[model samples]
Target: MTATLMTGTDLAAEMVAKAADRARALQERTGVQPCLATVLVGDDPASATYVRMKQNRSKKAGIGSRSVVLPAETTTEDLVAELTKLSEDPAVHGILLQHPVPAQIDERAAFEAIDPAKDVDGVTTRSFGAMAFGEPGFRSATPGGIMRLLEAYDVPIAGAHAVVIGRSPILGKPVGMLLLASNATVTYTHSRTTDLPAIVRTADIVVAAVGRANFLQGDWLKPGAVVVDAGYNEGNVGDVDFAAAAEVASLITPVPGGVGPMTIALLLEQAVDAAEAQTA
Candidate 1:
C-alpha cells in the first residue's frame, strides 16, 4: 500500500476554521473574545516568523493576540518580571514565550513565571506535571497537534510501541508523554543513544524530533510504521528523510506542511479555550 502523506497545514487550517466558528458562537453569547500574549526575546529570524504566523492565524480565527518583543540585551530578571506581569493580566488568557531566548537570559525561569492556567504554550513545570499525570491542563502545542493528527486519522495509539527520538522539554519529551497518556508504550532516544537506527526499526510509531536533517533513514523504519517528523532544520527540512521513509512507511508527516502549522493552530485553540474559561 502507498504511504499516506499527513498534511498538517491542511489539518491545522481546518482546525482553525472550526475554532473560529466556536469563538464567534462563544463571543455572541458571552461578549468575550479569546486573547493570546506572545513574548519574544532577541531577533531570531525564524522565531520572529513563527510568532508572526501564530499572530496571523489567531486573527484569522477571530482570536486576539498581543506581542511583546524584547531586545537581545534584555536580562533574565527583566524577562521574568515581564512574563510575571503578563501572567497577572486579566485580559491575557494565554501566555507563550518563544523559545531560544538570548544566551544570557534564563529561559526556564521565565517560563516558570507563567501561571499554569494561562500557560497555553505548556512550557511551565506545572503544565509538564499536568501532562504527565493526564490532568486537565493545556498541552504543549506541537505535542497536542501530533496527538490530534493521530486521532483525526484514526491511528491507533493504544497497545502500540512508539519511539521518540529527541528529549527536549518542548517537543520530544512532551510528545512521548502524550503518547504514553494514550496508552502507547514509549521509548525516548537522543543524540547520545547508541544503535539509533535499530531502536527506530523496532517502533510501530516513530516520531523524529532530533533536529538533525534526514537523520532517520528509510530502511530504519518498520514497514507500515507510522512516522511523524517534527524537526524543522534550515531550508525547512525535517528530521526524517521524508522521501525515503515515505517509500517504506505506511503513514508519514512531511517537513514544512506537517507539524509546523499545527503548532500554531493548537496554540490558538488553547488560547481560545483559556479565554472562555476566564470569562465563564
Candidate 2:
C-alpha cells in the first residue's frame, strides 16, 4: 500500500493562528507585546535565510522581532555577553541563536548564557534536561514540532520501536528522548552505527535527522513503518529517499513542507507562552 503523506503545512498554520490570538490577548491585557530575539553570527547564506523567515513569521503572529547580527570573527566571550544582555531584557520574551555559529565560538557556552526562562528555541542545557525528564519547559523547536506532528496525525507512539538515525545534540538525541517519554522504545544511531539499514528495518517509527540528503533507503524501512524526515539538505532534499520510502512505509513527511513549518510554529507559540509567564 502507498504511504499516506503527513503534511504539516496546514497544521502549522493553525498553530500560528492560535499563537497570534494569544499574542494579541497578552498585549491587550498587559501592554506587553511578546517579542522574540534572534542572534545570527557569520554570513552563512542558509542560516541567514532561516533567521529572516523566522523573523517574518514572528511579525505576522503579532510577536515583535529583534535581529542581532554579529561578525564572523566574534569571540566566545563577546557572544556570551550579548546573549546575557538579551536574557536580562524584560521586553524580550524569547531568544534564539542560529545554529552553527563560528567555529571559534564555544556554541555550548553561548547556549548556556541564555536564561532558561527565555530559551524559547530551547538550545540551553537546562531546557534539554527538562525535556528529557518530561518536565514543563521549552522544547527544542524541531523535536517539539515532530512530536506535535505525530500527535496530530494520530501516530501510535507508545510501545513502538523508534530508530533515530542521527546523534546531533539538538535534533537526534532530543527527539529520541521525547519518543522515550511517550513510551516508545528508542534506538539512536549515528554515522558510526554498523548495520544501519538492519536497525531501521526493526523500527515501527523512523526519524531521519542525519543531515545527509537521501541517506535512508526505502528498503531499510519496515513495510508499515512511519517515516519522519527532519533533514533539509542542499536543494530541499531530505534524509530519506522520499519517493522510494513512500512506496513501502505507511506514512511519510516531506522535506520542505513537513518538519520545517512546524518547527517555526512551535518556536513562536513557545515565545508567546514565555511572555505570559514572565508577565504573570
- Candidate with top lDDT is 2
Query: lDDT of each structure?
Result: 0.90, 0.96
Itemize residue pairs with steric clashes in candidate 2: none
Candidate 2: where are CA atoms >4 Å away? none
C-alpha TM-scores of all predictions? 0.97, 0.99
**Cα shift from native, residue 48, model 1 (Å):** 1.0
TM-score for candidate 1, residues paired by index? 0.97
Per-residue error at 183 for model 1, in Å? 0.8
Worst 10 residues of 1 by lDDT: 1-10
Candidate 1 error regions (>4 Å): none
Tens-digit lDDT string for candidate 2 (1-280): 4999998999999999999999999999999999999999999999999999999999999999999999999999999999999999998999999999989999999999999999998888898998899999999999999999999999999999999999888899889999999999999999999999999999999999999999999999999999999999999999999999999999999988999999999999999999999999
